[model samples]
Target: MKRLARALFASVFLSVMLAALLSLAPVLSKHGSGSLPVFRVEQPMHLTEGTLVDFLSRQSMNMRLHHVEWERNSLTLDLSTTRLTNERYREMYLLIQRTLTQTDNVESVRLTVYDASPATPAPLMTVRATRGDLRKSPAVQQESERSYQQYLERFFEVKRY
Candidate 1:
């Protein structure tokens, strides 16, 4: 009788452990690799708009994509980046504009940035420019993001930084 009871308890324990492991398999498959999984059926793009959004959102935990509107060759991005200093806002804006303008599908880009840290949804800034404008700067379309932001304020600014 005692041996039968011990065997039954061992079987139940093994069954529960197996059940728990099976339950976690799907989640572990998605996240256990320390990076997000890719399950796309489309052709691979190292940096398309989706990846761009991911990169921007990951820059700071507070920054997020609020909305998006796509026209024929123009793209509009609405971002909620909690109260940012002038430098930070410029950094994000240029990063977004420069990379997006390089893509084939995007001829122009518009960004409407909102400050989400305030109690009343404070300041908002909107800038819209085309690939031609982005490329016609002092760098002649050949500057790193840091250097590019320096001299193209006219082409890229809607108001203050």
Candidate 2:
């Protein structure tokens, strides 16, 4: 009876230890720098939410919308796509610039899209948009506010001025 109990205890202990070691294998084998490199967007342009999301979806890309500030007329999106070719990535940036330029509400668009794929190896894209200065003219302000209000009504349920 003693011998059997000892053997069972030994087997259980060994199994537990083996499981623990296997679980920690990833942590132990990780030798490279754990930090990811940051890439800056070269030239950013203004863009609309609809246009941005449409382009991404058309390309079958994934993205996360981080922050949207209508007052500042800016938005920040994180590119979550993994299959972007270098050329395609550049093309996307150009598309954004062109689209923003075409939009009536965008006063000036500047972008600095970049990727940090070589380290931590994840692709990221960021966009920032600024609305044109309509404060100078009451008519322009009213028109812009109306358009912005329409956008809000279409996309959000919250009441906004």
Candidate 3:
């Protein structure tokens, strides 16, 4: 009777362990199989109008930019997203790069997409500065702001008779 009870207890424990392992399988697979490199904004990207929030939502698949760390000439962004496919991730990366490149404070936008696997840890993209790239000088920043204001004024097309 004692031996039988011990066997039954051991069987119950094994079943419970198996159940737990099975439940965790999907989560582990996702984490291991499709992990992607996260992007970081390395400068204070003074967004024009509502573009900043819009950009983040679209790029990170509605994930909010939780934290921002500012350095001397750079800013690091902590962004979160649910789960993105390779194509979606690439599209988001390009969109950010394009937007940043359009800004004066952004000298260059580098996108480093991490591999989906640990053995192949490499960035998928590395955008470099193009020629005639506006330097992040104070004058350039001021000029850019002035230009944006002027553009907005023109865009509104308010007439003075």
Candidate 4:
């Protein structure tokens, strides 16, 4: 009876240790430097999110992008700020369109910016553009105009002077 109990206890302890090690393996590689993850090819969404975050952090215009989601052929970025400006919108839209449109995997990109001004409820402004539309000159300009209009409508609410 003693021998059987000892064997059982040893096996259980070993199994638990092995399970813990296996679970922690993936997390161990994520905490290091700016070095690109070796497993990026297997997970395209992670690759995209990491790249965008790095790019935004390096840019002059401050952007607080809270969430990034990749669904099917689309990537969505959720950005929030106390205030937003015209130049910020232009910079973000151009950067995303220029960078992601060239990639083979993504077809559409949507940027959802939330205005977190203190007086009123947060207003949302979404701008969506396809890869083909971004590639065309007229379509790109149109999309930019539309995005700017949407931003003005949502936050500024341009009243006729």
| Leading candidate by lDDT | 1
- Estimate, for each residue in 1-112, the C-alpha lDDT of model 3 and write its tens digit: 9999999999999999999999999888779878644674555446544445554554533433445433333334443344435444445434444545544554333332
Clashing pairs in 2: 41-112, 41-113, 42-112, 42-113, 43-111, 44-110, 44-111, 45-110, 45-111, 46-109
Using alpha carbons, what is the TM-score of model 2? Answer: 0.28
Superposing all C-alpha atoms, what RMSD in Å does each candidate have to the true structure? 11.9, 18.1, 19.3, 14.8
How far off is residue 109 in model 1, in Å? 0.8
| Stronger candidate by lDDT (1 vs 2) | 1
Q: For candidate 4, lDDT tens digit of each residue in 11-50?
A: 9999999999999976776665546766666333333655
- Tens digit of per-residue lDDT, candidate 1, span 1-161: 99999999999999999999999998987776775457744442244556556544544433567787766766677777666555555565565555454355567777777788877654467767777776665453444454433443556656544
Residue pairs clashing, model 4: none
Candidate 4 to native Cα RMSD, angstroms: 14.8
After the best TM-score superposition of candidate 1, give how far the Cα of residue 128 lies from its true spot, in angstroms.
1.2
Which candidate, 2 or 4, would have the higher TM-score against the true structure? 4
Model 2 gets an lDDT of 0.43
Question: What are the models' TM-scores?
Answer: 0.49, 0.28, 0.29, 0.48
**Residue pairs in candidate 3 whose N, alpha carbon or C atoms collide under 3 angstroms:** 37-114, 42-74, 42-75, 43-75
Which residue window of length 10 is worst by lDDT in model 4? 152-161
Candidate 1 local lDDT, residue 115: 81
Give the alpha carbon lDDT tens digit for every residue of 116-150 in model 2: 43555343433333343222223423445444334
Candidate 3 vs candidate 4: which has greater TM-score? Answer: 4
